[model samples]
Target: MAEEGVMAHIPINHPARPVYRVLAGLIGLYIVVFGVFGLVETAGDDFFSRGSHWVLGLRTNMAFALVSVIFGLVVLFGAVHRGNLGHLMNLTAGVVFLVVGLAMLTVLQTEANILNFSVSTVIVSMLFGLVLLATGLYDKVGPPEHAETEREMRSSSSARPGR
Candidate 1:
């Protein structure tokens, strides 16, 4: 089935899973630091002001900085937690970053751009989203038996013609 192929493509018990997890955690740490700097730079500013304040080479305001701090903390927690929690968090964060980037791009020159996003910020967000997505896709965990089955399925599928 198409769903089976989709689900089966995700590697289970990957050897590099820990590396990806650490990368995700590092991204979370970077976000937290950026947010902290943003908050400091935007102190006393209006929450949603479209001012030219910048942090870590990205435009930010009080509201965006606050949200970033919270989001980064949650991501950090997910990265530290064992099991599927990190997978889910990475997937969710990837989607959120992409959506926010697109949304901000659409309103870059409009008055509705509450996040104070710039082109560089959008690019960074999209890059982060893609990295997180890749990490999530390759970070699945499973028992030994499940991993063996997955390997077998992949081998069989690859051996088939026109598959």
Candidate 2:
């Protein structure tokens, strides 16, 4: 008997697998880079009050940087591991980002924004969220025709009688 290959078991029926991987990787990388830049720029200031860091042309603080880095890492992890779990992660992350961005838009310059919120940040976050959300829902768009063909092939082969 032939040894089953890894690809043989991994289901790739989803049309959005490639999209998810790319989105995750890009989003994760951008966040991580933003976090690193933020930390470096404010190295000498008080962690809580240091708001001189610039992320994507918008001002941000150390705390926000930390959150961005952590979130980015999670996204990167999901991107590297594609499957049902990864899709779920992407969906969850997208929702969270969208909510956070929308919430922040209401308190752009208020004291509530201890981490330096801005319109740019909100827009970028929402865009990323949309991308993630779309990619996550790719598999749900429709049933894959290939899966049906595969099933028919299996059933036909199993029904053949030859000793």
Candidate 3:
């Protein structure tokens, strides 16, 4: 009984396994939504020459929106599945975002960027990237072994109920 139930409840894997996946999924969803909003706001404009516009309060362009959609898809897929693949995807995306954000700083005054990133956009991107990167790199919590010992102890106690 009680001992058996306790042993059965011991998870085979780490308890923190779902944290990364859920975080990735959330990040992906946000990106997808903002991207779609950007696309809709800038619709009917020349894709290449589309002027910068703020969507969801973030400045962006059509190309950036498309890229965001693609990034979201990959991240979302990784989040939906469990394994090293998802972590890798999130790690890669985070790095890319970090690089893009840093690069945007150099061209803050210029108009050469297709993304038309602003100060807020750069800050947000870098922060988000850092979070994803750190979460992806975090080691999973190993299987709980102490539970087994507790179960055994409980079993021995339950077997002799004279006291």
Candidate 4:
């Protein structure tokens, strides 16, 4: 019997799966929060006058926040599902975070209020960028075999129909 309780996760899944998953989740959550914050600020009377004006007004930032939240959620689901789509989504998310972070860092720094931000926010944001970049350089874990199409798996697994 394969056991009726918690089944073992074999070695055929992504090895660095947890790493990417956690990173993606964190990134996604951050993005969601960031986006919400932006929306709130935008709706306020003094949003335009404080913080890095570029981040506050740029379309790219809006896109990044939305994608970040989405990627995080996808990665979280992938962690649970353990499939290719999840990892791919995470990879895309990481790439987006990395690219946006690098691009925006300069813009943020150039802003008049960059130096005025609470020290922790700046540090955390920088770390977030690095984590995303690292997550993008993913590693393959376990057997290369993974969730395949029904037709693909059928031809591949049908050799031993009674096994």
Ranking by lDDT: 1, 2, 3, 4
Compose the digit string of candidate 1's lDDT tens values, residues 1-163. Answer: 2346676678888988888889889989989998999999999999998999988889999998988899999878877766887887887888888898898799999989888889998998998888888878878877888888878889998999999
Angstrom error of the Cα, residue 37, model 2: value is 1.1
Q: Write the per-residue lDDT of candidate 4 for residues 1-163, one digit (tens) a residue.
A: 2324422222234457576667666655655665566555444334334434233323323334444356546645644445545545555555554565555555564564322333344445556656654554442233444523333545677786684
Least lDDT summed over 10 consecutive residues: which range in candidate 2? 1-10
- Residue 143 displacement (Å), model 3: 8.9
The pairs that clash in candidate 1 are none
lDDT of 3 by residue, 17-80 (tens): 5776688789889889988988887777666443768887788778878888888787788677
- Candidate 2 Cα lDDT to native: 0.73
lDDT of candidates 1 onward, in order: 0.86, 0.73, 0.72, 0.48
**Top-TM-score candidate index:** 1
Please report the candidate that would top lDDT against the real structure. Answer: 1
What's the number of clashes in each of the models? 0, 0, 0, 0
Q: If ranked by TM-score, best first, what sequence of candidates would result?
A: 1, 2, 3, 4
Can you write out model 2's per-residue Cα lDDT over 98-144, one digit (the tens) per residue?
99998889888787887777888999889989887766565222246
Clashing residue pairs found in predicted model 2: none
> Candidate 4: where is the Cα deviation over 4 Å?
1-12, 44-81, 106-126, 136-163
Kindly report which residue pairs in candidate 4 clash with one another.
none
RMSD of each: 2.0, 9.3, 9.7, 11.6
> How many pairs in model 1 have backbone atoms within 3 A of each other, for residues 3 or more apart or on separate chains, i.e. clashes?
0
Query: Can you give the lDDT of residue 112 in candidate 2?
Result: 83
